[model samples]
Target: MAASVGRGAPAAGPEAGGALWAEVWALLPGTEEGLTLALSGEVDDCVRPLLRRARGLLYGAEGRPGEEAAAAALRRLGDVLRDYSWEKLNAGPWREISKAWRQVYTYGCLFGALAEVAAGRPLAPAVRLCDMGLLMGASVLDNVLARLVRVLQQHLPREQRRGAAGLAAESVRTEPRPAPAVRPEDALPRLRCPSLEHFRDNYLIPQKPVVLEGIMDHWPCMRKWSVDYFCQVAGCRTVPVELGTRYTDEEWSQKLMTVGDFISQYIVNENSMGYLAQHQLFDQIPELKEDISIPDYCCLGEGEEEHITINAWFGPEGTISPLHQDPQQNFLAQVFGRKYIRLYSPQDSENLYPHESQILHNTSQVDVEDPDLVKFPNFRKAAFQSCILMPGQVLFIPVKYWHYVRSLDVSFSVSFWWS
Candidate 1:
């Protein structure tokens, strides 16, 4: 019977939908037997009657036959599952059983619709089941059912298939573009442990970007902070992660995840860029706070010495901070890896094309690396300094100095902001 049913069904095409149905059959118990066992008395008592009623509705054997019955059955099943507190059940932890029950309900509803479609019923019934499944948080089920629906659509005529294909294409999403690259015209000066007065006089006073080397040598983080060390120390702590390669992109968003998952997904593997930028990580994980000290250059600013705000910037290679300026003096210390930085002096703000919007006033609209000369012709005149900040080095960026930063490798940077 199973072989005959399989042979009678139309091919689902070469794409994911065909394979998805195969996986659905494998994951859902009793589905391979054409749901005969589930519809009969062979399965457990709790779900057996529901499955029977669902099958009856799909096959037009119950209540006002066709799509209406299928829709009603789906709603009833959804309501039953929603109100049945699985957590209170005698089964193990709800989390442990949630996946299995979700799979069961999803496959039960979808397979009923599939049976109807195979019997020459309309495809709208199946689509409704899948859509309602999604609304019920049956993501795994909805994903498979959606693929199955596409596979079924292959049986439709060319015009109908085109419309279905258009709808499916509209549902698919695209990944965001990678961060912009850096192209520096002039190089930044490199200083080796300059005296406080020299740093204040040359770089701080002039509002220039300079790489101050050998400043982070005393910090324990330079030696002890590694992927494994972070996992052991701060793995469980929850932190906000910036999702895209650049925050300036429209698709960019933030999510909260454990530090361990962030490292494994973004650092150890090149899945997607995740950044812990501009976060007060030290305040949350005080143990990590003990590894580093504030740089002396921060004192050169006019603000009170104790009031300086420290932010941690940690991310994998290709993460970018678009050309933007902060209101306070910044001493960015590179602790783990190298980074490419470009800075435009405050005097050249007119050439930088700062965004007109109030919130983005500090950010430049022109892509510094690939400036659209036709639109922003004056951008060509923007004088900027650039440098590659290495471990144990600090770059003092005076207040309102437009700067763009990109990590060259897996990196961790700490910044001190003072007025």
Candidate 2:
């Protein structure tokens, strides 16, 4: 579908510049009134002119003379925005960053989508553009690109949305699910679809950890999620992944890559350990969120429940999360694969040898699997409960309970944390 706009040079003027704005505006629905760009600070100063010039390329009285340049400019503007955003986003101290950086990202996405639209792409490719933007950008701009993409998507058939191939047909690499290295002296209690009152009294109120079964059998993910499924829907979406063994390692660092590439290189090929850990992946990809549901356990409270903090952990076998604890209670749901998890009661914190630094105060210095009895002699006294959390199982971890986790195979887990 060749764009109606011109691909070569055409006349330019103030009229053309203003018309370019109109062109993008007119392409989407319900924008007859107007549209606005949400930009701020220094990043805005650099991005404004690029966007204006790109718009300037779309305007022309005859043949839309600046059309090709407009299309090119839009694509280039997206790249420019990403470069600027990365400069700030990739810097250290991730938890301290604000949404201002993401605003610039939205501009890039909007313009990128505009470029894709101008090129007259098919529905899937166009939707991919919007998906990437949504995955990376903040809620800024008028959502012009998203709106346009939605309009295009209405014509898409349901089969295409679900994908042509099933995940079973496309196993990249299959391997044995690991058996526990050290069998637990004790195992967590499991209840089949326990009632809310029963769970609250036995677990929540008492601050006891338990493995929940039967509640998640209905979740769509149990049947639908697979390597091929992710590649089909989110192959192009970029996600941050931890590199080099684990975060505790001196060489450990994070890198951003498309999910497909991550799956191919780290998951399928087993080049090196790359864990997509502690990311709000559900927020990044809401369509995937539909496959799972928040536990009713999180909703139990006085008047109203606070928002749950959800994170995704996706990686291959042997990925380790060093001993750590969080302030809030956690429901660690195993969507697929198994994880050998060990949990020590908060009373045993002294034996855990927590890091003295404020940043890692909640993290224990002693390795749970291979403790150094000489240096961390107290660790041996810590009593812990353990389990091999399997698919469709949810492990309730009480607040401040010291725990360590190791994946047994390629895995995907979602955690919901609440105060």
Candidate 3:
């Protein structure tokens, strides 16, 4: 018979409304203290060897004995069930509780008669009966897992939820500001390509922003890592975050899966995010010393042209960079499509109504289109710099300059920084 319960079924009713836990409890001896201890300890010890084997098998590691594979998988599943029990005992945040319950609800049905049998007094016959078929039974495990994840995510802070929703929203209604003249002082110095001595003397010490468009033009990624190439070479590594509109739980799942896939599958995300900080890759590229790395598909090319990088492929309308500033001077290069950037200078801090704290002073309030002048009257006079970065164009953003970025189309970019 099928195992697993549906929500809204009265827990007090006969058969407990198909509840998996109810079935397990029904098969067990009375829930006495001695029985609880015996069951918990036996489950813990009996499952250890299986867990060890399963851990190695799941990751495709070598050296696990062939005979141990089934035991290992079973042990891992048992551990998951054990944790589910503990979760109920220690209820804290709704999300944490929901997650634990969800795991049990989805995977419990798959555990089959073993879940019921194990909860009961251990018998010789029960031991012999436990087999692979017990685990293969269809259960509501995956569905329950999905629902729980959604419930937990929906509990995010209202502001954060709003911000996340705006990720894919249509661009602001205000007309684009007129382009500013690119004065020589505003341009990054045209130093000889790779040496740090020149970059420091010209750009770093003085805090100048420069566009190094031609420098990395030859990097393999510059030409090959387009959306099509990414989907082909990397496969679903780019996430689809909601930059503008509210996302259903299903939409959020798609976004998260895509983001997680990108991070797990790509070397660029790993390397750029400092996962390989001590590896030979860093030794080969000196430009990365000052770049604050983010976990995304950022890469450094070989040869003297290696640049510290932060990159992401935005799908449809993707992650909109909330208005914030980084610590280091920036060299943001657009390699595909277009990205809109709005900038506010550090000198204009008073008019920008910077927060009192030194570290977070660069962050700006939302609702930029309509500011409450009574609270921050000076915001109206704040000087603004704006640009729409196109493929092969790089924009220099000095430290502490407030910036809000929007992907104009499916886009990708490489951003580098140096002290």
Local distance difference test values of all predictions, in order: 0.64, 0.71, 0.40
Cα lDDT tens digits, model 3, 362-415, are 666543545788888888787665656767666767777777776555555656
Write the residue-wise lDDT of candidate 1 on 7-97 in tens digits.
2232233321254334434433333335452221132457655655554443344544344344445446544543342332326754555
Top candidate (TM-score): 2
Q: List the residue pairs that clash in candidate 1.
A: none
Write the residue-wise lDDT of candidate 2 on 242-335 in tens digits.
9866678889998877676677777776667898885557766666788988888877743244367888998888899999998888999999
Q: What shift in Å separates residue 160 of candidate 3 from its native position after superposition?
A: 33
Q: What's the C-alpha lDDT at position 365 in model 2?
A: 92
Total backbone clashes of candidate 2, pairs 3 or more residues apart or in separate chains: 1
Report lDDT (Cα) of residue 91, candidate 1.
Answer: 61
Give candidate 2's error at residue 142 in angstroms. 7.2
lDDT of 1 at 334: 89
Question: Ten consecutive residues with minimal summed lDDT in candidate 3?
Answer: 272-281
Q: Which candidate is the best by lDDT?
A: 2
Candidate with better TM-score, 2 vs 3 = 2
